[model samples]
Target: MEHITSVHNPRIKAWKKLQRKRERDRSGLFLAEGRHLVEEALKSEVQVKVIIIEESVELPPEWQVSDVEVIEVPEKVLRELAETETPQGMTAVCERPDRHNLLLESGRFLLLDRIQDPGNLGSILRTAEAAGMTGVIFGEGCADPYNGKVVRATQGALFSMHVQQMDLEEAVDLCRENGVPIFGTSLSGSTFTAIAPQDSFALLLGNEGEGVDEALLEKADQNLYIPIYGRSDSLNVGVAAGILIYHLRGD
Candidate 1:
């Protein structure tokens, strides 16, 4: 195993840039911090390029994979690459999966439109994976799923599901081709309970503040919404997503 002692090491500098969206896009890889995320990535088919661990942290015997390089770094170097207050002492660089495959999968999907908050996007993804949804589609204006905050919030779900980004209109057209009914969430739409759960469908969720786009809403086969009986005018996008996703999954 190689050891890095300086925070200014060339590799450490490059890993720090992974914190930015453009860097991740350009490099076609993202940093997975902590033992849990790294372990999950290793278990998946996603190619693990390099694993970095703080020198003081012990390496699990299971992490002794033959093909990948393992580097032990000092606390300062680990801290520079960490996004959390308390570093987990381990991180890995993993190749981003090909998202074009997301369009070919046949199952229920959660299509997010302009979800700006990383926390909300992450939580919704976690819920979608837990609910056995096939994948997630991110439309224009949505936060990047690979962002550190979003990945951390996903709690490893990032590696478990198929996630892709594209325009809402094109996504709608794809769903039409697949014979999948597109359901949009709207305040004035039908009550969610009114729509029966199905084997395959696409649920469209909109921005936190604006709800679904008017053009997309108009194209939806059906628009459904949860009844807000209490004083609160609306639900947090994540909370609303949980309610709708599980109910629609119906299993």
Candidate 2:
């Protein structure tokens, strides 16, 4: 196993560039930090190019025999690769896993339109995975699912779910052609309790402040709202997503 001690090592510098979206886009890879996320990446279909562990940390039995290169690095070098303040002593460089669009027959789908917050996007994905949704489509303006913050917030659920990025108008058209019912959540739409959840359906969630875009809402087969009797005006986008995803993916 090779040891990397210098932060300026060419390999070290290349991995660091993955912290930026543009760099990740160019390299087709992203960094997964911490022991848990590193393990998740290995178990997942995403190809892990390298696994770096602090020199003092013991390598897990599973990783010790893996085919990928394992690098033992000094604490400082490991820290340089980590996004968090306190490092977990391990991290990996993983190829971005491919995400395919759900076929119309795929059952349940979630579409996110203009979700700008990494935390919300991450939480939604976590919830979507838990709810057993088929896939998630990212429309324009949504946060990059590969963003470090989003990855951490997802707690590795990001790797387990199918995700695609495309224009939502096209997504709507795709669903419509395939006989999947489309539902949009909005303040002015019908209450959730008033509508029936279909077995094969697509749900659209919009920006935090603006709700679903007017144009996309118009394209939905139905627009549904969660009635809020409380003084608070609206639920956080993540919270709304969990409720809608669970209810729409009925028992």
Candidate 3:
């Protein structure tokens, strides 16, 4: 196996660059840190170009890495590449899945608009995957799914879930054509419980502060809101998403 000791090594420098969204976008790759996320990437359709392991850390014996390039680096190098406070000693450079040709299907989906918080976006992705969402569509102003904080926050769900970035108006039209109902969450809408859960639908979630955009809400077949029974005026977007996703899934 190839070994690198210096953070200044050309390859190490490039790997570190993956921390930035612009670099990730230009290279069509992102870094997956920690053992669990690396394992998830290897198990999923994601193409892993390289696995970097700290020299002192031993990987699980059962991991099948013969087909992929492996590199050994010192603790300093791993720390330099890590986004978290504690380094996991394992990281993978993985190509972003090409989702351009992903088809719109008749199943549960989540549509997000202007979700600026990476942590919230990650939580939503994790919850959507857990709730058996077919896919997630990212509208304008949403945080990039490949952002390091977002990637780590998602645990391993980012690997298996299908996500796309597109104009939401187009996404709504496509969902409509596929026979999926578009339900936007807003304060003025009927209580969510009033609407009948369907096998196929798109739940539109919006920015943390703004709620759903007025234009998109107008386009929705129906707008619904979760009731706030307590003194709290609202729920976190991620929490609200979990409740609505499972409820709409009829689980």
Candidate 4:
């Protein structure tokens, strides 16, 4: 039954600081707002230090209640802590969940190369998780997975899936080491029907505007392209990724 009402409260200031990345890294914590994400964080093995729930709210049965300090905050303060337009009236400060590096273990993977748009990355991530890809590697220049938009777009898959950050070259090397062949989607590459590999594989997806790096593209063991019969020459990376992931997953 503790309370944190004032915006100037020291703890409040610290919580707000998490809006920036530096503070998040320095503190080893990030903010999770809304009933769903916070609830998911609690269910996850991730460490949750404190939960700031709105005053007078009856929480879901699964919300973490005993292990951590629960504080009651004013609605205004809840709005300040949340990133969405409609504040969920709940937020928690929790440790960054550990992402599994399945590329080092599994033979199936998805490598995203510098795909910088948050929404596309998020959508692809959601699709990847649903498709049961063993893991997802974020190439060096990809958008931040922890970005609020991406995190929200994934719809809580971040809490469950294996997500990693590494350079595209190193990722390809990891796949090779683990006995997985890398596949890249590009125009003029052989049609997916022509060079399809078996179920065990890795997909290298590129940014929307620029596509894959030639260096990595050259390294791909399989070059698969989705044909476009219409005027558009290329599909949105997210859409292409979804199509490729579904096919590779044996949809």
Candidate 5:
């Protein structure tokens, strides 16, 4: 293992650049901070390029790292690369999984449209994974799934979930072509219970403030909404997603 004590090291500077979306996009890599995320990345198909640990921190014995490069850095250097306020001592530089070939033939999927909040996006993804949904499709204006807050909020779901970014209309068209029903959530739509549980379908959720895009809603096979019986006018997008994902998944 190599020990790097300086935050100004060339490699450290390169890794730090991943904090920005442009760098992540250009390099096709991102940082997985903390132990849980690093461990999850190692277990997933995603390729972990290198593991960086603070010299004072020890990795779990069970983690397999013989094939991966391990580097040691001082706590200050680790903090330079960490997104969290308190550094977790371990982080990994991982290649972003290729999602270009995701199949749309059959399975339960969560399609997000312009979901801006990183926390909301993360929670929705974690819920989708737990509900056994096939994957997640991110529409334009949605928070970058690789954002630090989003990644941490996922709680390791980022490694296991199949996520794709594209225009939602194209996704809707693909689902329609594949015979998968698309359900959009909206206040004007029918109650969610009105629709029968589906074996395979796509649930289209919208922004935090605005509901699903009106144009996209128009294209959906059906539109539905969770009833707001309480004084509250609406549910948080993440909360609403949890309710609808499980109901639509019917599992």
Candidate 6:
């Protein structure tokens, strides 16, 4: 495989376009850079259409990206398509995650209500995957889960879980129709332990400042809060979300 010498190459142009969220959205595609993320995508069954690696970078045999075009690029050219400050010298164009069409068929779900920070959303996604969450739902007012920071935060769990966006009420309604309960964190409700673990439930998290929406709280099946002893007014959204996810996982 010849290494690309020209950053002006058409393939390079198309990938650079991915730096803009609109282009990624318009094409329903996103670029995951680095050896590990691409490898994880492959392991998680994501379709990799193009992989660009630096000169002489050896690949493990099981990478198994048979139909995908594997090409080498000059380190500078690879940097041109990269979003990171520290370029990893590898990148892969992947199909956008297709978890939207899925119903919350799994009894366990995480609902992020108007959770606006990309990093928080990303960390929550990673935690959800680690805590064995069945799926995640991002409702209105939440940041785009596919945003670059969020994508990176999930590590490769973005490929490992079912994630979808929806209206808050409709998402809660979907869970309700299937007989699953929804839990939201607040300053009051039952201590996490008091609520016995059910086989299925949705853990709802709200905006960092506003807490869960009043309408959503009205709709939720259980309003629960973490018992905080610290002087701080509330926990970070990511920390709060992690606590709830673990509790539901039966901590």
Per-residue lDDT over 96-177 for candidate 3, one digit per residue giving the tens place of the 0 to 100 score:
9988655666888899999999999999999988888999999999999999989988998998999999899999989888
Model 4 clash pairs are none
lDDT of each residue in 101-120, candidate 1, tens digit only: 67633689888999999999
**Residue 47, candidate 4: how far off, in angstroms?**
2.5
Error of 5 at 58 (Å): 1.0
Clashing pairs in 5: none
**Residue pairs with backbone overlap in model 3:** none
lDDT of residue 181 for candidate 3? 93
Per-candidate Cα lDDT values, in order, are 0.89, 0.89, 0.92, 0.81, 0.91, 0.82
lDDT of 6 by residue, 166-247 (tens): 8878888888888888887778667777788677888889998898988888888889887779897878989988877777
Q: Across residues 149-213, which tens digit of lDDT does each residue of candidate 5 receive?
A: 89989998988899999888999999999999999998888999998889999999999888888
Ranking by lDDT: 3, 5, 1, 2, 6, 4
Residue 133, candidate 4: alpha-carbon lDDT = 81
lDDT of 2 by residue, 1-251 (tens): 99989999999999999999999889889988998898888788888888989998977776643688889999999988888999998998988987664565658999999999999999999999899898999998999999998998898999888988888999899899888899999888888877766688899999999988999999998899888889999999999999988887778
lDDT of 5 at 155: 90
What lDDT would candidate 2 get against the real structure? 0.89
Residue 249 error, candidate 5, Å: 1.2
lDDT agreement of model 5 with the native: 0.91
Q: Please give the lDDT score at residue 53 for candidate 3.
A: 98
lDDT of 3 at 190: 90
Where's the lowest-lDDT run of ten residues in candidate 6? Answer: 97-106
